[model samples]
Target chain A: MAKQFKSLHPTKFYRDYLNHDIRPDGRLISKFRPVIINIGSIATADGSALVRIGKTTVICGIKAELCPPKSERPNEGFLICNVDLPPLCSSKFRPGPPSDLAQITTRFLADLILNSACIDLKDLCIVKEKLVWCLYADIICLDHDGCIIDACLLVLLTALKTVRLPGVEYDAAIDKKTINEDEQKSLSIYNTPVSTTYAMFEDKVITDPTAEEEEISSGLLTIVVKNKELCSIHKPGGSPLSEEKLYDCISETINHADLLITLINTAVAEQND
Target chain B: MEGKQRSNVKFVFLKCGVVSQAKGSAYFEVDNTKLIVSVYDPREIPKKTDYSSKGELFCIFKYAPFSCPNRRAHQPDADEKQHSAIVKRALESAVCRHEFPNFQVDVYILVLENDGSALSGAITAAGIALAQAGIPMYDTITAATLAIQGTTKLLDPTLEEETLCTVATHKSDTEIDYDSHGIIVLAMLSTHEQISEFYQLGNLDLETLNESVNILMNAAKDIVPLVEKCLVDYVTKTLKSNAES
Candidate 1:
């Protein structure tokens, strides 16, 4: 049933459904597909989270290592986020360097997580300038259905929150840092940022567009909200949104942001228990 | 390491079609080492190519950063690149390349954990994945690793055992022994009883190397039943679904 509809002139089929305020998947315009989260599945990583938003699946693994602090930010730790879109995820991507879409998503995530100060870098500092923890977060897309950025942000936040850095024994004079594998401390998470993306087809707006819908939509808007405050708004190279449409999208984002935060917290709590 | 009571081989668990997105995939787990291999259907080679009758195989081997004791890089390191090439070579002989000329089959292997004998596991997993994808092959390929320490040879060595076997020994003026210690990895096509690829990491005498190959061939043969069962189960499931439809 689903396959047959997908092959039928997808754009026109989607537009026809939008005319009646219905999605091909039968979800209301404001409703999102069901989400399932699996946390701490990868025992090798310090922190890991695998999330499936509808059919789009993402896995995030966080590794912590000791590194010399940067000259400019001697007292703070480092955070690096990389997004990999390999051919295994979808046929559309090839096996090589990060594609343009992957690069954009990586930078956007860096902006959302680092610039927004979701985690305090100073908290990651082991010993002032002598030694610091460098957290590398690698987000991989296993299956590409749609709304990859939204799934990636969710998994990254969840993975970062779950990170537990092992204690360390250091001698400054000898410049030796010994990691204590037994005792561990969790990273200090300042806030949780949730992103909601929408696709605009003509004047109609759809939330959490699938791969098919995204291809037909004319404009795209992503809103990031943390603790009831706006963090960032991304709308690059699509149809310009009028003031009213933009306001509506922002309000809709706010409504869904709260839902997403609760969903994430519940998932994290379940994993901890 | 002489009096150690470690088993030559550990129990392995194999399953096929684990990765839902890939055309064909398999997950192989032996002790602490775990690998997931995915195979994509044949597709046209992107760049213009000269006339060639045989199809191409593209293989990528990667280790997740957390898979090893030390964090690995996102990009494939030199060792990983070499392993990728080795895997491609191991499987190329088994696959019937003339079936899909001017096309390439992609095989991607991701090592989720590394205990020891990862290459053998990857080679074995790739073969099963290709078969699960319905790719015609002359025979199934299986691989095994052997670590030699002096006169003692260990089969399916663990990371620790492998390290012990590869350590540099002190040389004495009175007596010197060359090609006595090293690790050997051999891939074999079981039905044909042919050696597809062999990799050695250290020195080994000709006699000892022959003995190790014999041991590795037996171990590789032992794994054939497990792969056969997995592929048979996959085919049964597919046929059952087709019948119902």
Candidate 2:
């Protein structure tokens, strides 16, 4: 019925549907779409993965390089994340540089990953106060059907899980020049944090909105969960959301996070085999 | 005194902030062939032309001094300009220009390494840079250079192959011997199976030309899907990370 009325405003229709505890996509107020994940697809990258949430798609690749540890955190390695949304993904994106939106999203994702302590920085240290592995996680958006933040996090987690460092070889014959690939090890991960996004339109909250739904929504909230613990909360646009609604969203995110973790673990396990 | 010569060439893509001023920048290396491509964005149009129906895209291809084996001149040379024109045409056909009406997308490519098919490398670099910049297009364009030697066609021909192909074809002066006259480089659009751009430096017979196109097109078709998958995978990760954050 909603698809038939192309000209009708989604916000208005969503509001009407919310009164009856339903969504236009035939899901309940808290329901999410099906998700699919694949890992270790890019052989060139140290670690990589591809994830899909309904029609939305994302890919994340991690490259590890040896570098000097930070002066402040000499015993630990560093992690940096970048997000690229090329014009080919959508008509709204233009060719040029990263837009303001992309910058914000990149920073936010980086903060979440760092704060969540998903990776153990100490294990990345090759030499105390000297050398460490600087892991660069580059995430790219190929399609923007909707629910971008959730899709991005899924790919990142899947990539990290599937990645294995090449063996590092210390060549005694060559003045201790180490061959990084010969002595490789897996990254030490403490916990996996999965993310979920919700769009609030006219007091009704929708889970994993599509691009069309996102465009019409007034505000969005992204919740990250690690092992049943809420690790991060991002509510861009500063729209007022009640504590009750926030808790509800978190509960729903935690539930979906379990499903996502299962999907990611299964994909990684398949790759290992 | 006949020894086989083999070239050891490797290419890697690095996310370097060389073009800090630009929105998205990437450094590409194919053995000694190094280049940096930067994407700007849908910025205000500088020209006073009323082509405001959609966004405008501008491409600038330059070769840095000392890029080649020879000591290059200080100013932009004629060959550089010609290469830039070819690259611009190839990109223009691949990108959807009508997406941005009043704004312009600027792609600046600086070649730091000059091996054979620098233009083709620059085109590929530009495509990646554009994707990094987050501009919306229908698909990513992947390009490869071909050298036809009699019945054999080589992909990503090295500098030695470049010279050999030139000599093998150019030395033949007669019109009937034109098929052996030189090599052809084609820039193809992989998705639609269309030839977005083509460049042939040497003379070739019509039959040879048709055969070369077919060979190159088939090779390009094989490569297009790989590039598309790469782009798709990249974007999917970015979105997932965003959601997680």
Candidate 3:
């Protein structure tokens, strides 16, 4: 009987739970899914992390390669971030090409990482205008659940924290270099930015909505926080909320970000070097 | 040398022999999956101030707007970019880079239709295109793909089979018991039996993966004769046209 009503009137079913100040998953409206983080599992990658928020699982692997720095930015290296949502993750995605959602998430994450100054590009430079390190950070979604942005954000940050840069001996005149992997240095992260996603359907707002809830929602907002400061408020145009409500979401996300940072730092420290 | 500052980048031919910089081009078709590849001449590495002792190869893989069910963007997406990287890696070992120092060769692959095994197909077609362009190569390259669901290994999976290996369908009433399913693509040098690139996705145990590699190699070998025959035909046709002209 409950399944019939849920399949027939999904919005009404969710509304019933929301009115009762609880969610169908036995959590409060402001509650979030449990996050499980694992770091440095992929040995091939310089840094790697797998994060799970509820059923949404995302793995981020960072591979470092050497290339000449761009002429305009000779002192800085490159950071290329790509998110792949393959058919293995879910049936909604196909095998041939990346879906629209995959592209959008990738672009959004790249933008956020840049704006937040999470990792300074200058740190990746090996030699000015001659040789530099290019970090290819690839985030693959293994399972499609709800609130993937939060998981992707956490996993990316965690992966970045685990990165170790190798020492290189450079000959600027000949433009050749030899790597010394024995002398490794960890990355210096500038900021730890974490995000929280909220779905607003009608007037009621729910935090860390599931995939089903996201569909029923008319508006979705993601708030990114760096420490106590709000870094980004990404609302890709859904129902607009009042200023008071937006402030409330930001406050909640700031608190959530603090909690996530502590958890991530502990996980990083626990990982074997 | 006496002229004003000129653009270093060359915009070669538009058509095969016309005003294009590309030296060689080839079109490949396998069932509904069709693609075209063009190889450009070795040129100075553009916008690179540093010197390279050996040449570099850059590949771009893209699909047409209507190639698949959904509309593709003009810019290459993550999958296409990754495909380009794999193709580059597969072809990198085959090419003799010492011949073209401080230069770069650009290979462009455009898939007109996507049936299945597009990446493997792109590798095979790119190899042919490189050869047709008179690029230095160690040996001919070939590739194949395999789809595994449980114990059933489907060689050269169609689009539907590929999807099946990707993820179980939502419409299926019963739960899929056996969790093993995956697709593997292997690119190899058929003459020397050297595998250049191997890519896999899905949840398959190591045992299944080991068996799947053998199956893919066999399938790749089966296609070698066709590729050789196609190249022989291309050479003969060109020779005949030269005689006539």
Candidate 4:
């Protein structure tokens, strides 16, 4: 591991900033950076979206393939989400195997997708037990400035909205194969889930924490919510927080979700138009 | 490429190439692993202290964080540097470096997703990039790695399979079968049917090494034509546009 220099002491500075009701970036604690969402950037994938939250940038590509469903859930389709943090994004990431942080983030995003009630798995099933459409949602962090979770979620949701699955064709003669590009159908989703991450330092909650801020923070909280319901809450931190504070973080995330979803919808609407 | 599992792993080239900025670019996917490569010409070399008669080629290989099941670190590491050197060597062998004296061409490869065989993917990408940049090359180079697990030889093993095989082979006290021992990565120039570079990890015997070379040469033979076709198509398109202009 490379030696790293500590930035400002977030625990002490955050407390001062909170007392003054000012964040390090000169915004209120509840504020977020200016976000821009673009859909259908990758023409090769079934659906794709590019999102930029402040300086953090992410690209999400969703590809749907046919595969055998798991034995327990033979009637439903499968959703797999993977996040890639290339070295170009940051100097800290190595090129080969994934580190612990990458694994945790991938799992967290997968949980968010699974719990969101967004895509109807039954519709993805080609046959009862034999074949199902497996949607692979691959998220690439092109540039990591901060607020990765929120930017990643925005990309995933926008990509999902723009995705159109090729129609599935079934042939009785052969053991069952989903039709090729010419014969496929798009998937219908119920709700879109947006995620917001907050870093709490020195009794102050900072929204869209930057890379430097994340390094010095006491604890980090990621909240994934859909339609006012909490889908996933991932808190990987050393410092403990009071239940009341956690509740405040969740509420703040929910409020952020409302704006994120609107932004996603508008981006999709513009793409369609 | 030389081993029992060589046949199981296959490389396929898809035509009607994508990626517009590259002078010559092609998309090749080895089974589940996919990569796109674009080559830029020998532009004016960066003004620096040293200017060798042999031209320089700048290479950059990137794996999208989600390329593997686990998220990739947000930075480059030693492995990337090592692979970059390997790619440079593989291309240097086939390219006529003296032709572009005082000039440098750049090869940029991006791995969209990686199931296995990322190094080989980069080698193939660099070859395409070189051709795209209109640099004269004797032939295209194709590279592949072969790993042995016990009596079973695995071609292009995934990260999981690689770990399992490495542990299983190194732990046992049984007689070391050089044929099924260690990992061998080979790069071959298809037209000449010659080995450009060979790297081995762990212990291996001469016979196994020979067999591995043969296997990789065969794989290179299969890949060369596809790359040629892509290059021809690209050149034809460029000539047509030039005539029209």
Better of 1 and 3 by TM-score: 1
Q: Which 10 consecutive positions of candidate 2 chain B have the poorest summed lDDT?
A: B1-10
DockQ for each model: 0.42, 0.07, 0.02, 0.05
Q: For residues A1-273, write the lDDT of model 3, one tens digit per residue.
A: 998999999989999988998988798988988988988865556788889888787777787888999999999999887787654344354445778988888899999988888889999998898888988887877567778788888898999999988899999778678889799898899889999999998888889998788989999999998879988888888997989999999999988887899999999888743
Ranking by DockQ: 1, 2, 4, 3
By summed lDDT, the worst window of 10 consecutive residues in model 1 chain B runs over B1-10
Q: Tell me the spans in candidate 4 whose CA falls farther than 4 Å from its real position.
A: A1-19, A176-184, B1-60, B63-245
- Docking band of candidate 3: incorrect
lDDT per model vs. reference: 0.86, 0.70, 0.78, 0.72
For TM-score, candidate 1 versus 4, the one ahead is 1
Number of the top-ranking candidate, with lDDT as the measure: 1
Q: Stretches of candidate 1 above 4 Å error?
A: A1-9, A16-31, A240-273, B3-9, B170-174, B236-245
Best TM-score among the predictions, by candidate number? 1
Q: What share of the true interface contacts does each candidate keep?
A: 0.36, 0.00, 0.00, 0.04
User: What TM-score does prediction 2 earn?
Assistant: 0.63
Tens digit of per-residue lDDT, candidate 2, span A1-273: 646554576567667777898866687867788898977655456787878888676777677777778899989987788776655455576655777767888888888887888888787877677567787777766566777878887888778777687655333345353665566577766788888888888777888887877888889889888889888988888468899999998898888878888888788778777
